[model samples]
Target: MNQDIIKSQWKQLKGEVKQKWARLTDDDLTLIEGKRDVLEGKIQERYGLARDKAEAEVRDFEQRLRKH
Candidate 1:
Protein backbone atom coordinates (compact mmCIF):
# COMPACT_ATOMS: atom_id res chain seq x y z
CA MET A 1 0.00 0.00 0.00
CA ASN A 2 1.07 3.53 -0.65
CA GLN A 3 2.08 5.69 2.29
CA ASP A 4 -0.72 8.15 1.62
CA ILE A 5 -3.26 5.37 1.52
CA ILE A 6 -1.95 3.95 4.76
CA LYS A 7 -2.12 7.32 6.42
CA SER A 8 -5.62 7.92 5.22
CA GLN A 9 -6.77 4.49 6.34
CA TRP A 10 -4.91 4.53 9.60
CA LYS A 11 -7.87 4.54 11.93
CA GLN A 12 -9.27 1.47 10.29
CA LEU A 13 -5.91 -0.25 10.16
CA LYS A 14 -4.85 0.33 13.76
CA GLY A 15 -6.58 -2.77 15.06
CA GLU A 16 -4.87 -4.93 12.46
CA VAL A 17 -1.55 -3.39 13.27
CA LYS A 18 -2.02 -4.12 16.97
CA GLN A 19 -2.87 -7.69 16.14
CA LYS A 20 0.25 -8.03 14.02
CA TRP A 21 2.60 -6.45 16.56
CA ALA A 22 1.12 -7.06 19.96
CA ARG A 23 4.23 -5.85 21.69
CA LEU A 24 3.47 -2.30 20.70
CA THR A 25 1.88 -0.12 23.35
CA ASP A 26 -1.07 2.22 22.99
CA ASP A 27 1.34 5.10 23.37
CA ASP A 28 3.38 3.74 20.50
CA LEU A 29 0.33 3.67 18.28
CA THR A 30 -0.57 7.22 19.22
CA LEU A 31 2.98 8.29 18.47
CA ILE A 32 3.00 6.51 15.15
CA GLU A 33 -0.22 8.27 14.11
CA GLY A 34 -0.20 6.91 10.56
CA LYS A 35 3.40 7.67 9.73
CA ARG A 36 5.06 4.67 8.09
CA ASP A 37 8.49 5.73 9.27
CA VAL A 38 7.28 6.00 12.85
CA LEU A 39 5.59 2.64 12.63
CA GLU A 40 8.80 1.06 11.35
CA GLY A 41 10.83 2.69 14.07
CA LYS A 42 8.45 1.52 16.81
CA ILE A 43 8.43 -2.02 15.45
CA GLN A 44 12.21 -2.02 15.40
CA GLU A 45 12.42 -0.70 18.93
CA ARG A 46 9.81 -3.04 20.39
CA TYR A 47 10.93 -6.17 18.56
CA GLY A 48 14.65 -5.44 18.54
CA LEU A 49 14.69 -5.85 14.78
CA ALA A 50 17.16 -4.23 12.44
CA ARG A 51 15.94 -1.37 10.25
CA ASP A 52 15.94 -3.49 7.10
CA LYS A 53 14.00 -6.28 8.75
CA ALA A 54 11.45 -3.81 10.11
CA GLU A 55 11.04 -2.23 6.72
CA ALA A 56 10.60 -5.63 5.11
CA GLU A 57 7.98 -6.61 7.65
CA VAL A 58 6.02 -3.41 7.04
CA ARG A 59 6.29 -3.88 3.29
CA ASP A 60 4.99 -7.42 3.62
CA PHE A 61 2.17 -6.13 5.78
CA GLU A 62 1.18 -3.55 3.20
CA GLN A 63 1.24 -6.20 0.47
CA ARG A 64 -1.04 -8.41 2.49
CA LEU A 65 -3.41 -5.54 3.06
CA ARG A 66 -3.46 -4.93 -0.66
CA LYS A 67 -4.44 -8.51 -1.31
CA HIS A 68 -7.41 -8.14 0.98
Candidate 2:
Protein backbone atom coordinates (compact mmCIF):
# COMPACT_ATOMS: atom_id res chain seq x y z
CA MET A 1 0.00 0.00 0.00
CA ASN A 2 1.09 3.55 -0.54
CA GLN A 3 2.26 5.50 2.49
CA ASP A 4 -0.34 8.17 1.91
CA ILE A 5 -3.08 5.58 1.72
CA ILE A 6 -1.81 4.02 4.94
CA LYS A 7 -1.83 7.39 6.64
CA SER A 8 -5.29 8.14 5.36
CA GLN A 9 -6.67 4.81 6.46
CA TRP A 10 -4.83 4.71 9.78
CA LYS A 11 -7.87 5.00 12.00
CA GLN A 12 -9.46 1.98 10.42
CA LEU A 13 -6.23 0.00 10.29
CA LYS A 14 -5.34 0.47 13.96
CA GLY A 15 -7.52 -2.36 15.17
CA GLU A 16 -6.13 -4.72 12.59
CA VAL A 17 -2.60 -3.64 13.41
CA LYS A 18 -3.21 -4.32 17.07
CA GLN A 19 -4.54 -7.74 16.20
CA LYS A 20 -1.46 -8.48 14.10
CA TRP A 21 0.93 -7.28 16.79
CA ALA A 22 -0.61 -7.94 20.15
CA ARG A 23 2.36 -6.50 22.00
CA LEU A 24 1.59 -3.03 20.72
CA THR A 25 -0.41 -0.87 23.09
CA ASP A 26 -2.94 1.78 22.14
CA ASP A 27 -0.38 4.41 23.04
CA ASP A 28 1.97 2.84 20.57
CA LEU A 29 -0.64 3.06 17.85
CA THR A 30 -1.30 6.71 18.58
CA LEU A 31 2.39 7.45 18.49
CA ILE A 32 2.79 5.51 15.28
CA GLU A 33 0.03 7.54 13.65
CA GLY A 34 0.28 5.49 10.45
CA LYS A 35 3.91 6.32 9.81
CA ARG A 36 5.47 3.21 8.35
CA ASP A 37 8.87 3.80 9.89
CA VAL A 38 7.38 4.43 13.30
CA LEU A 39 5.20 1.36 13.06
CA GLU A 40 8.23 -0.77 12.13
CA GLY A 41 10.21 0.73 14.99
CA LYS A 42 7.43 0.07 17.47
CA ILE A 43 7.07 -3.47 16.21
CA GLN A 44 10.80 -3.97 16.62
CA GLU A 45 10.79 -2.59 20.15
CA ARG A 46 7.70 -4.46 21.25
CA TYR A 47 8.53 -7.74 19.57
CA GLY A 48 12.34 -7.73 19.81
CA LEU A 49 12.66 -8.05 16.10
CA ALA A 50 15.69 -6.80 14.18
CA ARG A 51 15.30 -3.80 11.88
CA ASP A 52 15.22 -5.89 8.72
CA LYS A 53 12.72 -8.31 10.20
CA ALA A 54 10.48 -5.51 11.35
CA GLU A 55 10.60 -3.90 7.92
CA ALA A 56 9.77 -7.17 6.28
CA GLU A 57 6.92 -7.75 8.66
CA VAL A 58 5.47 -4.35 7.89
CA ARG A 59 5.89 -4.97 4.18
CA ASP A 60 4.10 -8.26 4.49
CA PHE A 61 1.37 -6.60 6.49
CA GLU A 62 0.95 -3.94 3.83
CA GLN A 63 0.72 -6.61 1.20
CA ARG A 64 -1.89 -8.48 3.18
CA LEU A 65 -3.92 -5.37 3.74
CA ARG A 66 -3.69 -4.57 0.04
CA LYS A 67 -5.16 -7.97 -0.77
CA HIS A 68 -8.17 -7.28 1.41
Indicate the worst ten consecutive residues by lDDT in candidate 1: 1-10
- TM-score of every candidate: 0.97, 0.98
lDDT of 2 by residue, 1-68 (tens): 99999999999999999999999999999999999999999999999999999999999999998888
Candidate 1 residue-wise lDDT, 1-68, digit = tens:
77889889999999999999999999999899899999999999999999999999999999999999
Span of ten consecutive residues with least summed lDDT in model 2: 59-68
lDDT for model 1, please.
0.95
Q: Would you list the C-alpha lDDT of every candidate in the order shown? A: 0.95, 0.96
Model 1 deviation from native, Cα RMSD in Å? 0.5
* Candidate 1 lDDT for residue 49: 100
Clashes of 2: 0
Model 1 misplaced stretches (Cα beyond 4 Å): none
User: Which candidate number would show the highest TM-score if scored against the true structure?
Assistant: 2
